[model samples]
Target chain A: MKYWGTLLLLPSLLFAQPEFFGYFESEASTMQLGSTNYNFGFNKFRLDVEARPNDHVQIGANINIQQYWGKTSWDVYDFIPVDHPTGQGLIFTIPDTILLDNFYMKLSFKLADLTVGRQQVSPGVGYAWNPVDIFNSKSLMDPSYEQPGVNALRVDIPLGDRSTVSSIILPKDVLDESTHQFTLKSGIGSFDLTATAAYESEKDWQTPLLGRYDVSERNLIGGSVIGEMLGWGVWVEGAYNTLKIDIPPWSSFLPPDSEETYAEYVVGIDHTFDNSLYMLVEYLHNELGVKKQENLSLNHYIFALEGEVNSLMQDYTFFYAMHPTFDYVTLSAIVFSNLNDTSGVFSPIIDWNVYEDTNLSFQGSLNWGDSDTEFGLQDWGLIMNITSTF
Target chain B: MKLKLLLLSPFLLLIAHAQGPTADQIVDRVTNIMSPENSHSKGSQTIITSSGKERVFEFESWAAEKGKSTLTRYTKPAAIRGQAFLMLNNADDIWSYFPRTKRIRKLASHAKKQKMQGSDFTYEDMGGGDVFQKKFKSRILTEETRDGAPTWKIEMSGIPEEDPPYPKIIMWVRQSDYYPIALDYYNEKDFNTKSLVLSDIQLIEEYPTAMEMVMTDNKERSSTTMRTLEITYAWEPPKGFFSERNLKK
Candidate 1:
């Protein structure tokens, strides 16, 4: 398309000599589940460019190209639709094409800063989970991956030395009233605080047997706090939502009321030792999640699939550790456990800095539990990546 | 008058040579010259591996209260940019800020013995000030010529109860300005484990300063070269700039 041609040539033409940097990564992974196994090989290349033509304006863009080839026992097409090929809101992935991760222009004024275009706008302080991050919901499985961006307009105004107010506007094809977010952040004494509010529109909950049901509009309110205590770093974030949904005429078994309210919260702490050993622990409670298997049904499963809830388990815990064993080698481990089911996934990773800009990493994940419990459906997985940045 | 003045010139030169400073006085002067009351510097460090591979890091440093409080923030190598370290005057605690997580971690005491930023320099090496006089006993070993400059060879041994990183250090202090040109560090086993050389002497703020330095790890066969790009002195940083609250910024 014409846009693709322009995206390819714009970086080179904008500045005679621009600041260019990015990384090339190749990954090979194998997953084992029950009697079936899946193998995947991925090659990814990312290129970033930034140019500041003057003191008042700057432009930046990140282009990503990835090619994946493998065989899987499960159908990947079933999870993603033709209209949403990337399976994420921030990226656009074709069968065998490149994706634009970020492209934005920022203007600096005397009183405020304005940024427009597609860019990531993460505004929460939680390490493992951010309930207030409504713009981009990150995947806990691979937390290191760069988050995708959304097309929007943002404005940031400074209130004082240590406070700021930011607003973002996301526009869809048709003009609507429920696509704005406002956030206020400030530093008080040793703690940093943030409060945010946003509006969300209803969408259909899809199911395999039943067609679709309309969900009601929702309003989200959240806040977060981060500070240091004694020698440890602590953070807490929580979000509350008010929702209204109408049940279908035939579904008389559902609850009579069409209104609901729920909340989610996470508390975390982290520390580092003299031997270059770092540790982090976090606990999360999702009110929308089902507490027990008996409570899980077709209706709740559909809600989970529609991104209304995080997991089937209500209580979850996360632990992470990083130890520098050698001069250029680091060993890391991460675990996510569903406290209710006592099932979890454990991942061990090793990173070696072979050269100044070259790195090699080996990662493995092992899941434990029965078939019906959380993380019990899959067996084990292994991934190795070689990346070089410039 | 001309004959009398010509005769006293040699005597005046001899008097100046004889009045050279003592070892303790020379150490005190070097400490003061190196760590000013309030200073700022921008520098780059290059770590060279045994196989000749190199990695460079750039940083900005600020010190106040004659190096009693200090802060250093990395500015280059995108992966490490925005990372910072703060050292306060009240305690030996060193706080580190990780930009990725937006967290500040306090390093343990034993971390002083570990290598700094994967370089040959240890954390104790960058913790500069009047620590030498407080921890080591100094005495002049001999007078010799180093790099064609007459120098006072000073040998300093750690106090018995101090438990320092190194047992002894041999320094070559230039007699002309009392600046240390080179140092040799010996471990408890009496092995020369590390060595440092200071070069490119220049005058900054009317004080003699070293613009280039190299630290070699004899056991590992590796070295790190540091060069000062810019430096200033006598400008006090803002109050509370070195506190934990500013680490997040």
Candidate 2:
């Protein structure tokens, strides 16, 4: 990551238009580990670079170096070795520092665009989906960022002044053990629709392949739509995946009714008060168990609300996700820095212009889950971020 | 200068003896006060606070005459620049234009009270005297001094006299310049909740120019301070700054 950052800075010495943007984040937490509270810190320093030599072509890449300086369980150690001795220690840090998050070359000819190489695939508003991010993906335990799980090609064709059609494809990789994944997206006016399909041979990073879950081959499909109405906006989305598990010798260890197919869907609403304030609410539900109807049916549900106050300050958002069957809630917040120039990805992420973007704020999420059946797991997180753009 | 003052002194004294002008007269004075021909110059600045927040803004203002006006902002790094506000305030009517995402949106009267750039000041503040004509009724109360300067104490109430954002404003104007030096904004409960303190008035070719103003809300711990660091009264600016090409560029 440091080397990539240095290379980007070198361009400043050349054309002086060294388009380099990056963010540095650090998180410290004290988790109530069963009976004891433990202190830990997660630090990440990332660098992103983009270069356009001419109007028709451009290249960009993002590299992040993260250090998980904390304690871990034996299972965590066995999966990904933390630099430490045998026993449970005070520090179990992952020293593999440099990770490539994105690298792609884009060519644009008038209204059309084409991109190739390892890239992040943000699909169907799911937040993080690795069907395309084949190189490195978000840990299923913590879905924050994703890596290219597969090398893919993307093309976007403009249909008219207010419409576009886009598609993407990824080839076989060592991990997925198979070839071919595809996605299609279309947009017109205030509405958008998307669909995806993929075939896998072995266990992909996105899914597990073990016991009855050891899926050597899998196929998936998804669709979504978003549009505006009388002074408000609405969105609808759905996704489904089918898995073929390799029957293993230890079949008795797994549940007898393990399902080979799963599906999820979400619907949302957004309204804007003039141009300054806006409110958005959404609900998401996943089908956890269909093969075993009595055991587990409805997986999880998310309900959230967000709003902006003005351009300079006073933007706030809150969200609550529930597990009705288990009786739990996931609470979250979205905040922005009103003091910074309203620019870049974080600007929209924080809704600075909607109210006052300069206001510094803190967002927190608390998850409540049940202990009896792992249906309701409880976890909480608080974050404070400051941002400015040039 | 002596002749001019002597000739104007009797008219001023007569107006004072008559107990200040009516609400309509006050509105006329305010409207004439901010004419493009009355202001010193036009330029743009990026406002940065002690907390490191910044916003870039530009205005084309005149002192005595009405002319074209424009305001634009850089919303993103690479996206085309867009107009934040545009107005052509003439003697007939005040018109404003807003660029839309897909088309254009025209603003109406009710939007004036909303804050500008999320600051305490509203578009109504920028509207100056336009809304005052129809929305308010004023009467002169007494002679007063603000910050040791002579002023005319005035009482203004919305026509319906219902609770407005600020139900009343007691303005203190400099006797010599006729420019407000300070004012107290009162809420519906008749409490002096907010105040605007204007200072650093310099005579730009015989006009009292306000260099800075700080609006403080006593009820809340919040305040907005604006300091106009420089002013240029030239009629002609560098070419292309106000053109639509530059606005989109």
Winning candidate number (DockQ) = 1
Model 1 residue A181 lDDT score: 79
- Note the Cα lDDT for every prediction shown: 0.74, 0.45
Comparing to the true complex, what docking class would candidate 2 get? incorrect
- Per-residue error for A204 in candidate 2, Å, reads 3.2
Please, what is the TM-score per model? 0.72, 0.49
In model 1, the runs with Cα more than 4 Å from the true position are: A1-17, A72-97, A172-178, A202-216, A243-260, A298-308, B1-42, B49-53, B58-117, B120-198, B205-207, B215-223, B230-249
Candidate 2 lDDT by residue in tens digits, B1-249: 999999999999998877756645755575455444433344343433334454544444432233333333423322112334433232111123222121122233234444444444555454443444455677777777668877777676766543243567777656665677777877668888767787888776555667777776565434566556555555543333332222222
Per-residue accuracy of model 2 over A1-390 as CA lDDT, tens digit each: 525543753453246354666555565555442345555566776676767777666666677787766653323222211222335432223454787766666677665678776566554543222222222333212234333323567776655422346666664546356445555555454354566666656553221212123446666676766554543455666657665655455544334433456565656664434223434454444442222212321111100000000111112122222111110111223322111212111111221221122222244433333322221122344444432222
Error of 1 at A174 (Å): 7.5
